[model samples]
Target: MFKAFVKIAVLLSLTASMAFGYQAIRLNVSEGTYKERNDAFNGILEVDLEDAGFTPKDIHPKIEYYYKLFYGTKLLKDGKPNPQFKTDYVGNLDNLGFITISNEEWMRELLMKEPKLGSFAPLNYLIYKKKSEDKTYVGTLTPQAMLDIAEIKDAGVRAAFTEKIDALSDATDEGMGGEVEYVEIDKLPAKTLIEWEIPFDRGEDVLDAKFDFMEKFEKAFEAEEYIIAGKRDFAEYWVDNDLENDKYDAYWVYSLCHFTFSYTVFNVWEHPELGASAPCSMYMYLDKDSSTLKVGMPSVDNWAVFGKITDPKRLQFIKDMDSKIKEIMTSLGAKEI
Candidate 1:
């Protein structure tokens, strides 16, 4: 009892909350090299996950986009780096990578209930190692944290979502045998998301219109040097499975990342775990018979509270990103609501 008390006291003393006094990232540390722990995490998932599309990219050169996310086609860059602003910046970490994972069947059930979950449909399995420390870290934003950011309150949705998240967490712990730590916080900022809507009349076939819209969406962001990191189509999944869901005409989400912006925050800074919140998931959906296409994403301003990033320069960058994203959305005809 005394030992547990001492550990809690020491842990609390050693830990500091990020921006909003809550730690959404859950860290699982193991005593091994990056390769060993990474292998372990993968090994455990092989049997459990429906399909693990392991898109892992190594970062060291202050980096480039491993792949640009395309809307319709899975084919983006040929798994090659997309060039962005060149910097002499060298990564201080040895191994830094992001792998998104999810249970597809479980996720499909919850999407109609809480489409906002797309903001974290595929949670980031962030892994990193420091050049100075001989340790490996694996983590993701906690299920509760994702719920908070997405503002989902359905009890059924919460239960199912957390069940899936806990399973993955257990697998991670089982594979990487080490200390499980948390970046703890009590709550997030009052406004956790930035959102907008683009109104349109779906003439005859909405499918063709969606395709055209996506092409413009992809090109516009790419022209601005934003990497479309990942994408998922929830409505398509239901169609394949023949699952009857009447909630929406279409639902999909995109993970966006600015190469230079990420390089500055993760590689140049001490907190690679921030990647858990990353490759920011922006969701677009149109309800059944609804003409307004709704778009929403977690606000980067929340990073101030979530990341506990106090540096003057870094704070400005996060603020600028919030502005930049809103600008891009509005430019694409999305009116901020």
Candidate 2:
């Protein structure tokens, strides 16, 4: 009876082994002649999931999209895995990589200990070469050959949503320009902010001109309560008002015409009441080559008023503000350069 039972156990083991073929995938690495020890190294490992009866199309759609976005179409044949059809599917593993291991290996040593989830999808498996000799570590998936495609899809969807939000926020320009006035209140102490437009032929000259302007502006506004901010490339003069504790900030940009200048001003505290709650106080763009300062207005209601800014009232408001700025610059002895 004992001999028969042992024979049956061996037969069952053989049948199971035959049902699932075991194969080892090997990857080779080499060090280049000019390679530095501290420098980062990168390489691609071509995996044959076809042997396991899997194809790229079986991967979660979102993971596939991310993979394409990062690595491009180098791996996919005609934008998809070839061999047409297969019984097994290549499972998405959170857009990190594909799971080619089987379920039996899920609870194995290295994979089980390593935490696999990451916000940024892993593009390459980074390897560190030991100082003494070259070493390679092999890592495997934990959940086995069969994986939860839904989990990977969910992570991909969440990442896509986050990227969309970031793009929206970056495009948003709140408190750029609004219905604002220059109020010279007598009760408030006058603060002087001097800006300069200097022309330079070379890069070094540009730095010198900027430094020279800061020195002169500092002397001109030194008596009043002022703060000198920014480096030589561009600088700002800020004056504080005691009455309402309002601050007047002025930024100067190089104009298209030589020695011509353009500037923008804002009362930091008062503008917030105008619904400008941007983390940045202001934005200024200068075309040094063209000598033009294109002052962009805050698009606080940009999303709400997009494509509708063509309305007569809105157009007039923008034109009026532009005219006012030009007039102010003229009064400050700034010729339109």
Candidate 3:
């Protein structure tokens, strides 16, 4: 009986430790116009990252991705049918800044330990103005949170990821002098690896299937009333540029959106900042060793906790989206592993 009690206690402690699974790196820029501030923030990301020994691989793509989202959502809100939305709101609202940077090669190697970690790779950041506020806020989901939620158990890998994010945070605050807020969530669901696996040697069109699956996945979401905000084929770009190494062969991140759901949680709730998690990411990569294509994504549950979304409708939208992703993966012959 005592042994059983001790085991229960240990399990409870473990659960408690994982409750707060994320930290939000925040900065406030209050001096400039929304567009000026947004543009300055974009410059900040590039300068700060370069100063911190990191190189941002792409900026325009990320910015365009968000613009697509902003405009697509504007159309979705206009109640237009036939799968077309208005694009007239492009420059009407406050400008948004977005960018992506790849971690050091060593950090990428550490990712091999747990393929799911790729979801956090080419780390993305966003800077936006809230409707109720004058200051433009800059933030990113920290690497520590991604590692924790993905259940990364290697102490070394965990430390490395944390160090990388901490360094990025410091660089971001270089000249801003703003108090960076780290919102530690204390009630996150346990670490979850949302991945699917297929049976077969990878040589068999798993690569082709990756592309096909992405197409089907977008169509499926559209059929179910979702929008394809944007997508990045990281692996294709990497391989094309001869950036590929022996570690892995392919990778991609797809951004999806439900504007109606976002309207309630972001606009109605006055949590425009929550759009930081907008265009939710679904990433996939190949595991050369296992000869299996690994599909993984950080669940929407992270957004709920990190964004502090509590309304039933918002939460339900998250759950439904998660379920829908799984269903699409299954349809592609990849069973959740």
* Highest-lDDT candidate: 1
> Please, what is the whole-model Cα lDDT of each candidate in the order they appear?
0.72, 0.25, 0.60
Root-mean-square deviation of every model: 6.5, 31.1, 9.4
Clashes of each: 10, 13, 1
TM-scores, in order shown?
0.83, 0.19, 0.72
- In model 3, where do residues sit more than 4 Å from their true spots? 1-32, 53-95, 104-106, 191-193, 200-251, 255-264, 289-291
lDDT measured at residue 185 in model 2 versus the true structure, 0 to 100 = 15
Give the winner by lDDT: 1 or 3.
1
Worst 10 residues of 2 by lDDT: 257-266
All candidates in order of TM-score, best leading: 1, 3, 2
Model 3 over residues 1-337: C-alpha lDDT tens digits?
5434433543554465467443443443445566566655666665677766566654532343444465456445456552444444332225444455554354455756766666666566666565445666666766656677667888888887878775665555543434444455665566455877765355467677566656666777788778776566655765666664576666666666676565545544555555555556666776555666667777777777777767898788878878877776787678887
lDDT of 1 by residue, 71-119 (tens): 1124335755434323344546766677655544667778878888878
Which 10-residue span in candidate 3 carries the lowest summed lDDT?
84-93
lDDT of 3: 0.60
For candidate 1, the per-residue lDDT at 98 reads 71
Q: What value does the lDDT take at residue 234 in candidate 1? A: 71
Task: List, residue by residue over 14-55, the lDDT tens digit for candidate 2.
Answer: 465455532111112234321331121111122322222222
Q: Which residues of candidate 2, in runs, are more than 4 Å off?
A: 1-204, 214-328, 331-337
